[model samples]
Target: MSAMTTTPRTVTVRTSAAGFVGGIWHFARREFRDAIASKWFILYTIAFTVLAVGVSFLSLSGVGSHGFAGFGRTAAGLLNLIMLVVPLMALTAGAGSIAGERERGTLLYLLAQPVSRTQLLLGKYLGLAAALVCSLCIGFGVSAVVLAWRADGVGTGSFAMLMSFTAMLALSMLSLGMLISVISRRTGVATGVGLFTWLTLVFVSDLGLMASSIIFKLRVQEIFGLAALNPLQSFKMAVIVNMNASLDVLGPVGAYASQTLGGALPWLLASSLLAWTLAPLGLAMLLFGRRSSV
Candidate 1:
C-alpha cells in the first residue's frame, strides 16, 4: 500500500470587502483605467484645451493693453464649452460599456459570474465618473480664476449653486449613457444612438422652445415653461441664473431663483437634473437584468 499525500486548498472570503465599499472601488477603478487607455480621451482633451485657451486669449486681447481685460467673458464662454463637452465625454464613457462587452462576447462571462448586473453597472458608472472628475476639476479650476476676476461683487452663492448643478449633470450624463448601453446589441449602435440622443436633449429642446415661442408668441412665463421641461436646458438656465446674477439679460435673479421655498423655477430645474441622474440609472438596471449577449 502506498500513502497518498494531498494538500487541501482552503477558501477564504475577503474580510475587508463588505457593503458597497468594494463595489464603489471596483466601479471607480474600471472607469478610470479604461478612460486613460482610450485614445479619444487624449485627443478630445487636447482639442478642447487648445480651443478654450485660444478663445480666452482673444477675449483678453480685446481689453485695453492688459489691465484685467475682457478675459472674464472669454473664460465664461470657455466654461460653457467645457460644460457641453463634459456630458458628451461622459456619455461616450458609459453608452458602450456593456454593449461593447456584449458585442465582443465577454458579457456572457460576466453574467455567468456570481456578481449581479447592478454591481457591474455601478462599478462602470463610478469608474467613468471618477475619470471624468479629473478633467472637470482641472478645467473648472482654471475657469474659476476668470470667474473670480469678473465677480463684480456677485455673491459666492451662485458659484456654489453652479458647482452643485455641474456635479448632478455629470451623474445624469453617466446614467443616460448606461441606459443607452443596454438598449442596443452592438456597441457601435449604442454609441451612435447615445450621441444622437444627447444632441436631441441638449440642442433640440432649445430649438423646440424657440419654435414654441414663435408658434405661441407667448409671454415670458410661457417661454420659461417650455425651457423648464428640458433637462439640459433647465440646467443651463439655472447655471446662467446663478453664474451671471450681476447681469440683467437673464432676469431679477439671473433667470430663475434657487431653493424652492420661494417658488419653483430654480428648484424645478434642479429636480430635472436629479431626475435625469436617477431615472436613467434605474432603467438601465432593469434592462441589464434581462440582457443576454450571445
Candidate 2:
C-alpha cells in the first residue's frame, strides 16, 4: 500500500513540474503571437532592416587600398549603429510589456490564471526576446547577403561576434525596460522613463564621462571603470576589442583596459553585460511579485 501511495505522489510531482513549464510556454507563445501582429513589430522589423542595409552600403563606400572595407571597419560602424537602435527598440518593447497590459485591462485576466507572477514575467521576456531575435535575423541576414556579394574581405567570424554583442545589448536594455515597466503604473510613464534612460545612457553618460575625465583628470583605470558600468559602452568595448588589434581608438582608457586585461577584456565586458541583463530583471520580478493588486 505504501509503495502504491509513493508511486502516485511521484507521478503527481512530475506532472505538476511539467504543467508549470507548459504554462510559462503557453504565455510566451501567446505574447509572441500578439507582438507579431502589432504595428510596432512591423515598424521595428523595417527599421532594423533598413538600418542594417544602409550601414552596409555606407561602410563599403570608404574602403582602403583593397577596394573593399574589411570586417573590422564594417563591424565598427555597425556596432555604433546597433548600439543606437537596438537599445531603443528593446527599451520601448520592454516598457510596454507589463504596464501596457495593465493599462489595457488584460493584466487582471492574466493574473487570474494559474500561472505565478514570476512565470508570467519570464514568459513575457521570452516572447519579447524571440520577437527581437527574429528581427535581428531578418536584418542581419539581408545585410550579410549584401556584404558577401559586394565585399571580398569581410570576415564572417567577426561579423558573427558583432551580432552576438548586439543581442546581449538588447537583452540588457530589455531588462532595464522591464524594471521601468514594473515601477511605473502607467504605460506613458514607463515609456517616457525608458526614453529618458536610453538618452542618458547613450548620450548623456558619454558626455558626463568625458567631462569627468577632462575636468577631474581621472586616471585610466577610473575612466575605464566608469565606461564599463554603462551597458552600451561595455558592448562597444567588446566589439572593438574583438575586431581591432589596438584599443587606442578609445583613447587612453581603452589602452589601459587593453594592457591590463589583455585578451580577457572581451570576456570581462561580456560579463558586465550579462550582469546588467540579470540584475534588472531580477529586481523587476521581485517588485512585480510583491504587488497585491496585480
Candidate 3:
C-alpha cells in the first residue's frame, strides 16, 4: 500500500486498407519520378519520335513514283517498328526494376518500411506503365499530328487502333520483364533473360510456327490456335484485320483467323493481351511475396 505502482501504457497502431493503398500510390509516384529522370527514357523517346516522323514523312512525301502513301501504310510501318522497339525498351525498363534496386542496396531499406510486397510490386508496375505510356504517346502523338496535318486526316481510325494495340503490347512486355526481374537474383541475369524472352517471342516463335506447319502439316484451325498463343502474333493479326490489310500475305492461318474470328478477332486478341499483361505480374507478386527480401 505504501509503494506507488505505475502501469505501462499500451498503444496499438493499425494500418487501414485505404492507408495501404495510399502507400502504394506514394511509392508509385516516387518510381515515376525516378523513371522520367532516367537518360534511357529520354533516348527512347527521341528514337521513337524520329522513327515515327521519318516513316510518316516518307509515306506521305511522294518522293518516289512507287512510294507508299496514306495513313494505312504509315500505321503499318509504325506497328512493325513498335513491335520491335517497344517490347525491347519495356523489357529493359521492367527487367531491372527490382533486381536493379536490390543491386543498388536500396531494396532492403525499402523493404524495411511499413509496406507490403504486393503494394511495392503493383506500385512499381504502375510507375513503369505510366512512363512507357507517356513515351509512346509523345512519339506516336507527334506522328499522328504530322500525319493529320500533311496527309489530310488519313487513316485516323487506323492510327487510333494502332496506338491502342501498341499500348497493350507494351504493357504485356513490361509484365513479362517484371516477372524476369522478380526471378533473377541479379540485374544482369534479369536483363539477359528479358532479352532472350523478347527474341524468342518476337522472332523465334514465328520460325517455330513455320517449322511446325511443315513438319506436322497443321490444318488451318491448328495453325490459328498455335499463332494465337504468341502475343506478338495476336497483335499483328489484330492490327492487320482492324486496318483491313491484305490477308493474302498472312497465309492460311491469317485467312482462317480472319474468317473464323471475323468481327470477334479484335476482342479475342484484346482479351489475350489482357491475360498476357496480368498473368505474369500476378505470378511475380506471388513469388515476391514468398521470397525473402533479405
Candidate 4:
C-alpha cells in the first residue's frame, strides 16, 4: 500500500490601509510626467508666456502711460486675458484626459491595476492641475517680473490674489472638463462638449442673463443669482471684488450682489468656485466607479 500526501497550496495577498494614497501618487506622477512631455504643453506654455508678456508691455506702455503702474493695474489689465485663456487651456487638457485614455485603449490597462477608481480619478485631476498651475505660474511670473522692473513695483497682495483667483478658475474649468470626459464615450465628443461648455459659461450665459432680464423683467437679485450659477461669472465677480474695483461696473447685478451679499460676496464667490472645482470631480468619481473598464 502506498500513501499519497497532497501539499497545501499557499496564496499571498498584500493589503494596506494607506495604500490608496500611494496609488494616487503613483498615477499622479505618471500623468504629470506625461502631461509635461506633450507638445501641446510646450506650445501652451509658449503661447501663455508670449501673450502675458505682450499684455504686460501693452499695459505698461498704454495703460501705465496714465501713471497706472503696479500690480493692481497689471492684474486688472490681465484679468480679461486670464479669464478668457486659462479656462480654454484647462478645458482642452482635461477634456482629453479620461476619454483619450479610453480611446487609446490604455484605460483598461490602467484599471487592471489594484488602484481604486476614486484614487485614480483624484490622481489624474491632481496631476493635470499641477501641470496647468505650473504653466500659469511661469507665464504670469514672467509678467510679474517685467511689471516689477518697469513699474514702481507690483502690489504683492493684489498679485497674489490674482494668481489665486486664476488658479481657482482653472481648477473649476478642469473639473467641468473631467466630468464631460467621464460622460463621453469618445475623446472627440468630450472635446466638443468641453468647448460648448466653455462658450456657454463664458459668453452665452451673460447674454442669456440679459435676455432673461429683458424678457422676464427679472430683478437685479435674480440676475445676480443666475449669473452666480456660472462659475466664470463668479470668478469675474470675485476678481473684481477682490481687486476693489468699482461695483458700478457690474451694473445692477453687481449693486444688488454687493448690497445683499455684502462684504461676503468675495468669500461667497470663492466658496462657490471651490464648490465648482469639487462637485464635478465628486460626480465623475461616482460615474467612473459605477462604470466597467471594458
Identify the candidate with maximal TM-score. Answer: 4
State the lDDT of candidate 3 residue by residue for 69-182, as single tens digits.
578778778878888889998998999999999889888899888888888999999999999999999998999888877777756677778889989999999999999999
Prediction 4 TM-score vs. true:
0.92
Model 1: residues with Cα > 4 Å off, grouped in runs: 1-20, 64-72, 142-164, 216-219, 246-248, 251-265, 292-294
Clashing pairs in 2: none
The order by descending lDDT is: 2, 3, 4, 1
Q: Score each candidate by Cα lDDT.
A: 0.67, 0.86, 0.85, 0.85
lDDT of 1 at 260: 27
115-150: candidate 4 lDDT, tens digit per residue:
778888889999999999999999989997888787
Q: What is the lDDT for 97 in model 2? A: 94
- Top lDDT: which candidate number? 2
Task: Output the worst ten-in-a-row residue range by lDDT, candidate 3.
Answer: 60-69
Determine which window of 10 residues in candidate 2 has minimal summed lDDT: 6-15
Q: State every prediction's TM-score relative to the real structure.
A: 0.78, 0.91, 0.91, 0.92
Off by over 4 Å in 3: 1-12, 63-69, 245-249
Which residue pairs in model 3 clash with each other?
none
Clashes of each: 3, 0, 0, 0
User: What's model 1's TM-score?
Assistant: 0.78
Query: Candidate 2 has what TM-score?
Result: 0.91
